[model samples]
Target: MSRSQRKQEDPDLGVLSSRTLFSLQRELFTKLGEQGHPDLRPRHGAVLAYLDVAGSRATDLATQSGQHKQVIGTLVDELVALGYVERQPDPADRRAKLIVPTEKGLDHMAKSDAILAEMEAEHAKAVGEEAYAEFKRVFRLVAARQAGS
Candidate 1:
């Protein structure tokens, strides 16, 4: 079958474009793995992306990432075992602990930032800067709308 025919068969990809989003995420994770964070998975990214520089409670991270507290707790445990995150007593609440990124987590985030920049450059080149910018603008708008909803 021709490429056009295949695309027509999956028109949702052209309109909704979730495939593109997932593909980009996979590419970024692949880049991260190649850069030395071999154990990191896309699931780990949910917690990492929402993590605050100061520190965040696992429950807060779960809410921010739209994940359950138990799932976040498990991921946080793995991250701690990997030396990417550490739990410390929360001064505000002695019964709770805050999840803080370790030096290793900071390093991974640094590499992720660089890789994302490179990916953006490549995407801009492939899709034209104007189109890429529009894509980002639309994504932000959609996200905002969803948040409002």
Candidate 2:
């Protein structure tokens, strides 16, 4: 956007980060869904990112996602219905169930990784590789700090 247009829209610069990120995320996921992952949703991204390919449990997902069991359960239910995950009896604790990723889930993860790499390249080109790398470094540091807190 032109400088005057940006200033007119947001003199405080309050909505820039979150609004742009949300818009970029939405566009990326929407295009991805059109490509092949039609069942995925924006809300599913967090829990899905935390999931291990080997296996886990609803409680584990909840812990990793920093969300409640009920919330993770809802996401798991959607994922299960969409054939991305399957629940099987946990061998260690027969009373508990293990949430395992289906082949389709792994496939989607791989595709999403590639798409993110492409996005990184685009960012690098826009701001130069050194700036982009520093940006990512700072982002990771902030995320790690927030995660610790």
Number of the top-ranking candidate, with lDDT as the measure = 1
Candidate 1 ranges with C-alpha deviation above 4 Å: 1-10, 13-17
Model 2 lDDT tens row, 39-95: 798788756777788888889888877889999888888999999888999889999
TM-scores for every predicted model: 0.83, 0.80
Off by more than 4 A, model 2: 1-17
Against the correct fold, how does model 1 do in TM-score? 0.83
The worst-scoring run of ten residues by lDDT in candidate 2 lies at 11-20
User: Clash number for model 2?
Assistant: 0
Error of 2 at 36 (Å): 1.4
